[model samples]
Structures are given as C-alpha cells and as structure tokens.
Target chain A: MNSTDSLIDQLAQDGAAPRPASLPRFVAPLALAMAICAIGIALVLEAPFIGMAINGPGPMLVKWGFSIALLLLSGFALWFIGRPGKATGATMATLAVPFILLAALLGADLAIGQRAFPGETWQRCLAAMAVMSPIAFGGAILAARWLAPTNLHRAGLVAGMFGGAAAMTAYSPHCPEHGMAYVAVFYCLPILTMAALGWLLGPRLLRW
Target chain B: MGKQTDFSGDTLDQLMASARAGDSAAYRRFLSEAAQRIRAMLARKIGADSELEDVVQECLIAIHAKRHTLDPGRPVAPWMYAIANYKLIDHWRRRGRSPIEFDDAADMAVAADTLASTDIETLLEKLPRAQADAIRMTHIEGLSNREAGERIGVGVSAMKLRVHRGMAQLKKIAEKDRI
Candidate 1:
C-alpha cells in the first residue's frame, strides 16, 4: 500500500478524529490587555482627565466614538488576518473606514473654526504610541500561537492597527483634549507606530 | 460504484464517512480511491512525475489525521477542496525554492547523491518523518504536496503544511549549508 493508504490505516488503527475550523480565539485577551495597560497606566499616572469621557456633549461623543469604532474594527481585522491566507480586500477597506470617518470629522472641525493642528500635545501622542507597543507585541505573540498566516507583512499591518486602536482607547481616558481633529491626527500616531513594527517584525514572529 | 472500493461522487463521501466510523476495510477502500483523485489533482497542477511522487503520501497522512475532525453529517467535498487548495499553494511555494540568495555555488543539490540530495536534502532528512518525506519527494523529486501526500497516504493539507515547514526549515539550513 502507498503512504496514503498507510496513513488511513494508521488513522483507523489509532481512531484519529477531527475538530471544527477555529476562529481567532485571542481577541478578548488582546482587548483586555490594551484596556488594562491603558487604564492601569493612567491610574498610576493620575491624569486629571480620567473619567471625563463618559460625560458628553455631541462633539465629545463623536470624538470618542471614532476611536472606539477603530478599536473594534482594527481588532477584528487583526484577528481575521492572523490566519493563513490573503488579507481580503474587504478587510483592508473596513480597516480604512474609521480613518475616512475621522478625517471627514476633521474637515468639519476646520470648517467650523478649529485649528487644523491643535495637537500641541505631540509629545503625549508619541508617549501614547509607545505605551501601546507592548499591547501590540502581546497581540502579535498571542495571535501567532497557531495562526500561521501566509502573508505576515499584511497581517502585521492590520495587527498594528488593531493593537494601536486598543492602546489609543486606553490612552483616551487621560488626554484633556477632545475633538475629531485631535483624534484623527494624534490618536493615529500609535497606529502608525504599530504599522511600522508589524511591517518590520511580523514576518519573523507570525510565521507558521 | 459496483465495488465497495469504487469511489465517485456520493460513493467517495460515504466511504469516507464509513471510515470515520472505524471500518478499517471501508477506510482502506476510501483511502485508495481518494488517493487516486488526489493523484490526478496533483498531476494536473504539477505536471512532473518525480516531484509529485512524494507529496501523495503526505496528503494521505493528513487526511487520515484530520478524518475525525470532520463533521460526519456534512459534505466532504468542501473540506477536501480547501485542503487541496492549501496543498497546491504550499507545493508551489516550495517549488519556488528560495533561489539560494547567498551561496556562490548556489547549487541546491550539494554533496553526495545527485541520484537525490542537496544541502536541502540533508536538512530535509532531519525533519519529522511526514515533513521530511514530503520534502524529499517534492523538493528533491519535484512532486506537488498532493502528489507527495498521496504517495505516503496523508491529507493534502497536512502534506502542504509539512512541505511548507520543511521548506522553511531548509531555508534556515541552507544558510548554514552554503558552500
């Protein structure tokens, strides 16, 4: 008998069974890690603006809404891309939606009278981005457990976006600033950091 | 359809289901029939007899391992198609052969046994049996993953994974094996 036959015989001999195809089971942990680090770090730092996000005028809701949406969308995209296959164009498009939505909000901000670059807190943006690096690292490591994605670079890019969103959510509680322009420009800093990390390091870490 | 072993359409699925239920005879018959289909698929994709030889074994091994994982009530074709596609992509990637970036000699087959060997060959020997065998057939013998798997009697997808891993390991080894 051929090797194939032997394998089948072996299965019959051993009673090997099958299981259902899996979804990315790591999403919860990654989101929680981002929240813990963001909130935990914020608590330690005693940033004055910590609980102000829940109270909202319409503008505040819009601002906070975008980051939260990004958090969910990017997180799911990262999970989907974590598997072995081409990152569907639909996934790419979905990931880009928050940016487009936020950018449009920024345009409206400028039309009304907001400064285009009210991001005097550029240093904070850099810090916030740095803070999420660990969260991203955690997500990448967690996702790699059995993911074995075929396109590591693309997966990494989405992974960064996902983790970065989670980090940005964590950091959001602290920042005194509130507006779409601030979020569109500043919140994305970490997302960019994540993309770079994913691009450079993902192929090595995520290989199956 | 006349013989219990003659697989086509629903007959193949029924045989596989029976095999999943632990009928060794049905399992054997199912395997032989499936191997033929897998062989045809590999031959169609790879078009080379030597390379195709090894992967068939891996494909069979994979299918056997994964048999219990399938929902017996469901149609098997979709699952097999997914496995076949995965195996084919994997086979093509190994066929790409990493192009020997650093070596001056750049020869994939090095040392003794042009009859069949390489620095690639040496590394392949150290791999797990299924993976090593898959690579030995696909890379050295130039078989597709399906072809290699059928030869060894494993699932195509499992063989593909073996080939992929085997090739990846070979790349690392090749870095050291560079002459």
Candidate 2:
C-alpha cells in the first residue's frame, strides 16, 4: 500500500464518527447569544419596556416578522455557503425578501404622507444593534469555524447578516421607533456594516 | 481494518451510512471504493497526468473531513463526484491550464508540418527564419537546446537565445491576434 492507502487506513482507525454539521447546530447557539444580549440591554440600557401590549400587536408583529425572517434566511444562507458543492445563489436571492418588504412598507408610509421620523430612542436602537451585532456575529463565527466553508466572503456576509438580524429581533421589544423608514435605515445600516466586517474577516477567520 | 472483509454486496450509500455510524470496517471499504471511482473519473477527464493521484487523495480527504454534510438517505455518487470535480478544478487551476487543452496543444506541437495549424505556421513564419527554426527544432521536434544547436551549427547559449526570442515574438503575435 502507498502513502494514500495508509492515510485512508489511518483515517478509518481514527474513526471519524459523524456529528452532523446541520443548521440547527449553529441556530441554537446564535439564538442563545441574542437572548443574552437582549437581556443585557434591557437591564443596562434602561430603554422603554413597551412590547406588543403598549405598541399594539400590529407594529410589533411587523418588526418581529421582518427581523425573524431575515434571521432564519440569513442563517440558512450561512449554512449553505459553508458547505462545499452547495449552490448559494438561490439562498442568497431569497434574502432579499425581507429587504423588499421593508422597502414596500416605507414606500406605503411615504405615500400616506405621515410626519414619520426617528423616534426619541433612535440612539438607544443604534446602540443596541451596535452591541448586539458583533456578539451575534462572534457566536456564528465560532460555530462556523469547523464547517470548512469554501467561499469565505459569502459565508462571512451571511454570518454578519445573521448577527444583524438577531440583534434587530432582540432590540425590537425595547425600541420605541415605529417608523418604517427609521427601521429600514438604522436597522439595516448596522447589518450592512456587520456584513462588511464579516466580508473582511471571513478570509482570515474562515480559512481552513 | 480487518483482513479481506467482504463488502461487495453493499452499495456506496449503504457503506457510507455504515461508516457514519462508527463502523470502521465499512468506512475502510467505502474509502477504497471511493478512491477507485475518483481515480477512474479523473483519468477520463485529465488523462494520465502526474497530478491525478494527488487529486484523488485530496478528494478522499475532503470526503472524510465533510462526511457529516452528506445525508445518509441520499445516493452517494453525486456527492462523491461533486467533491471530485472540485478537486479536479483545483488541480487544473494550480497547474495554470486545462489539462485536456494543454494535452491537445502538446499533440499539435508534436505533429509539426503535417498536422500543425496554419495559424501556428503563420505565427512561426512571422519570426526570423533562424529563431523560428530554433523554436521548432527544440520545442516541436523534442530536441534539447544543445542538440538543436548542433544541428543548426550554433552554440547552446545562442540556440537558447534564439528559442527565447522566438517564444517572446510568438506571444506578441498571439496577443495581437486577440485584439
């Protein structure tokens, strides 16, 4: 037997039993990380505690729907890009849904010509995202480090987007801003920035 | 890792599923079968290139490292080939040529006046006769620079210079053709 044959023998001897790298493996950790961030923000930041009860379910549901959709879609995209031979184009295109929904919401708001602007707690919203995005992103990176992602930049972008979405979801309860325009700009800005950060970091962190 | 264990009845999917479940004997059999399939596939694509074995090893390693990604319910052939194809692409990229096209180019060069392209003949004609003769004798005729120089009654360094100039001129001509 040649070196390759022996190498195969060694691999079998080592018994690389499968602990499957499924999407759920990363999701649980990411969800936990976001939950921790949300609680921390609530205790320290001292923002408005209004949830579906105070704001009514309509706006709160919309906010939760957008962020949660993004969270799940981006999580799926992240998992897709990390695997070799998986086509990420479809998953990536699917990510645009939430963004388009947000845009449509903002457009409708504008057509009605309400005097909507950033709410009093806009700083708190940005602050909450600024804190949460990186923590969520870090959790994702740790989980993805072992998956052997072939395309580092796309993986990173999805990871960052996943972080941004999680942060958005966690912060939604405390945020008083209901303007679609405000949510679109401030919420998306940190997510995009996190994506850029991930893009830059992916090559370095995800290199296997 | 047992001696001569029989696995002829099991399909690759069955073997892989067994491997995933911590059956080392099944894993060994699966890898050996995978190695043969990948070797045959690569031979068809790249012919008898030196990197063939290396690429097979790479595919095997990738399969081992990413075994968890495979769904046990699915057929194993597509997943195996996908990894094999990626390794082949990586091998070709590392070598800086599509091996099939490169092999064809080698064959055409060896064919010389009888089978050479008119485009190549025309390109060679554009060079000075001495430089063109040096390039053809060394490159196409499979002669060393010294042997080619001896045939043309020139020194080895002089022959080398002629071949170098001829190649540079050919590259310039080819680039111009693109424009």
Give the number of the best model, judged by TM-score. 2
Per-candidate clashes, comma-separated: 41, 0
lDDT tens readout by residue for model 2, A70-131: 98898778766666666778988998999899889889988888755876878878888899
| Residue A193 C-alpha lDDT in model 2 | 93
Q: Could you tell me the TM-score of candidate 1?
A: 0.60
* DockQ score of each predicted structure, in the order shown: 0.19, 0.31
- Give the interface RMSD of each candidate: 4.8, 2.2
Candidate 1 Cα outliers beyond 4 Å, as residue runs: A8-24, A28-32, A48-60, A78-87, A116-120, A196-201, B1-38, B53-179
Each model's TM-score, in the order given? 0.60, 0.68
